[model samples]
Target: MADIVDTAVSAGSFTSLVAAVQAAGLVDTLKGPGPFTVFAPTDDAFAKLPAGTVEALFNDIPQLTKILTYHVVSGKVMAADVVKLTSAKTVEGSEVKIDASNGVKINDATVTAADVVADNGVIHVIDSVLLPA
Candidate 1:
């Protein structure tokens, strides 16, 4: 299997997300040998943001990196394990709330798809992009 970066790129729906990851200079990190659990958002989800938000972020590398890393957890946490947790600490050094009482939610985003395995980790498709506190 490909790594997380390749996996997302191949998914096709994550164009905006993949670009953001690249702009943030995190391509190497995501492509590294780490079992990261990424709550990946689709291009449509990014469109949910107000106009100019994405552009503004792209100009701010630090903020973009923070927001991007906020979508990731340090280890590979599968959907089954994620459902059992109330929260998980993000690689950005913040905690994201997890609510599995219904489907699976990471903060305000709903998990649309789950357990997309990669060589370096897993991907859980979220309906919204996650932001840091």
Candidate 2:
């Protein structure tokens, strides 16, 4: 199996996300071992941001890294595991609330697709970019 980066690239829906990850210098980290659970936002999700939001973040590496890392948790949390949790700590050092009452939400983003397996971790596609509070 391919790594998270490769899997996302192959999926073709994460073009913006992959670009942001590259810009944030997180390609290596996400491809590394130890099982990360990434709530990956799609290109459409990035588009949901304000007009200048994506452009602004692209130039701010530190803040960009924070936002990208906020989407990641340090475990291979699948859909079943995620549904059982109320919250999970992110790699960015903040906790994201998980609400399974409707479908499944991480912070304010809805989980659109789940259990996308990767060699090093798992990816759950989300519908919005999760901004840290």
Candidate 3:
């Protein structure tokens, strides 16, 4: 199996996500031997941002990197493990709230697809982009 980056590439729904990761210079980290849990936001999710937010972020590498890194958490936490927690800290140093009362929610986003295995991590496709508090 390929890494998280490769998996997202294959799904073809995370175009903006891939670009953001590239912009953040996190491709190598996601490609490394890790067991990460990625709260992957689809391109559509990014569209939910305020108008021109994506463009502004793309223009600002540091801010974009921070937002992108907020989606990743160390360790490959699968769906089951997720339900046992109230929150999980991200690589970006922010904690994302988890709600399992109805399906699974990560902050304001819902996990549309979960437990997608990759060589380096697990990808949980979410419908909303997570922002740092």
Candidate 4:
């Protein structure tokens, strides 16, 4: 099995996300040994951002990294586990609200796909880009 980075690349729907990860210089970290749970946003999600938002983020590595890391949790928390949580602290150092009462939502994004297992972690595809406050 491939790592989180490779798994995302193969998914083919996260082109913008993959590029942002690379641009933010977090490729190695995602590829490293981790029990990470990534709330991955698809290219469509990134596209939903305002014009030039992505481009501007690419030039700001620190901001990009924070935004990217906000999608990750330290442990491999799968779908079942995620539903049980009201909140989870992200690697970015902020807590994301989780709501399972009505489907599963991570912050404002809905979970479109869940439990995409990777060698180093799990990936849960979300419909919107989650930004840290």
Candidate 5:
């Protein structure tokens, strides 16, 4: 399997996310060693954002990084492990509410796909992009 960066690129469903990651200069970081748990939002999820939101974020690195990091947890938390928790702290130092009672939801997004293997970690595809509160 490819690393986080390459795996995301290959998925083809995370264009907006990929662009944001690149803009935040986090591609290399996410591609590095160890394990990471990424709640990856699909391009469709980004499209749900109000017009100009994505564009506006790219121009603001701090905001973009904050939003992107909200989608990531520090360790390789697979679906099974995540379901056992009521919440998980993200790398951004914020807690994401996890509701596994009805499928799996992280914040306001629902997990559409889970346990996607990557060289550096795992990917759980979400239907909505998570924003920091």
Candidate 6:
């Protein structure tokens, strides 16, 4: 099985997300031996941001890294486990609210798909980009 980065690349819907991860210099980390749970945003989700938001993030590595890491949790928390929780602390050091009462929401983004298993972790597809306050 492929790692998170490879899995995301093969999925083909995470182009913007993959690029942002690379730009943030987090490719190795995501590819590492961690059992991460990533709330992945699709290209369409990234497009929902204001004009130039992505471009500006590319230039701001620190901010980009924060936002990217905010999508991840430390362990391989699958859909079943995620639904049982009210919140989860992200890799970015902030807690994201999980509202499974209504179709599973990670912060303001809805989980469109769940439990995409990768070698190193799991990916839950979300409809919007999650930002840390």
Provide the clashing-pair count of each candidate structure. Answer: 0, 0, 2, 0, 0, 0
Report the number of the highest-lDDT candidate. Answer: 6
Once fitted onto the true fold, the runs of candidate 5 whose alpha carbons sit more than 4 angstroms away are none
Residue-wise lDDT of candidate 6 within 1-133, one digit each (tens)? Answer: 9999999999999999999999999999999999999999999999999999999999999999999999999999999999999999999999999999989999899999999999999999999999999
| Local accuracy of candidate 1 as per-residue lDDT tens digits, 10-99 | 999999999999999999999999989999999999999999999999999999999999999999999999999999999999899999
Report residue 99 deviation for candidate 3 (angstroms): 0.6
lDDT of 1: 0.95
Per-residue lDDT tens digits for candidate 4, residues 1-133, read 9999999999999999999999988999999999899999999999999999999999899999999999999999999999999999999999999999999999999999999999999999999999999
| Residue 66 alpha-carbon offset, candidate 1, angstroms | 0.5
Which structure is stronger by TM-score: 3 or 4? 4
Q: Taking the tens digit of each residue's C-alpha lDDT, what string does model 2 give over 29-116?
A: 9888859999999999999999999999999999999999999999899999999999999999999999999999998899999999
Instruction: Give per-model CA RMSD.
Output: 0.5, 0.6, 0.7, 0.5, 0.6, 0.4
Inter-residue clash pairs, candidate 6 = none
* C-alpha lDDT score of every prediction, in listed order: 0.95, 0.95, 0.94, 0.96, 0.93, 0.97
Residue-level lDDT for 59 in candidate 4: 88
Question: Which residue pairs clash in candidate 4?
Answer: none
lDDT value for model 2:
0.95
lDDT of 3 by residue, 38-78 (tens): 99999999999999999999899999989988999999999
lDDT of 6 at 13: 100
TM-score of each: 0.99, 0.98, 0.98, 0.99, 0.98, 0.99
Off by over 4 Å in 6: none
Better of 4 and 5 by TM-score: 4
Q: Clash pairs of candidate 2? A: none
**TM-score quality measure for candidate 3:** 0.98
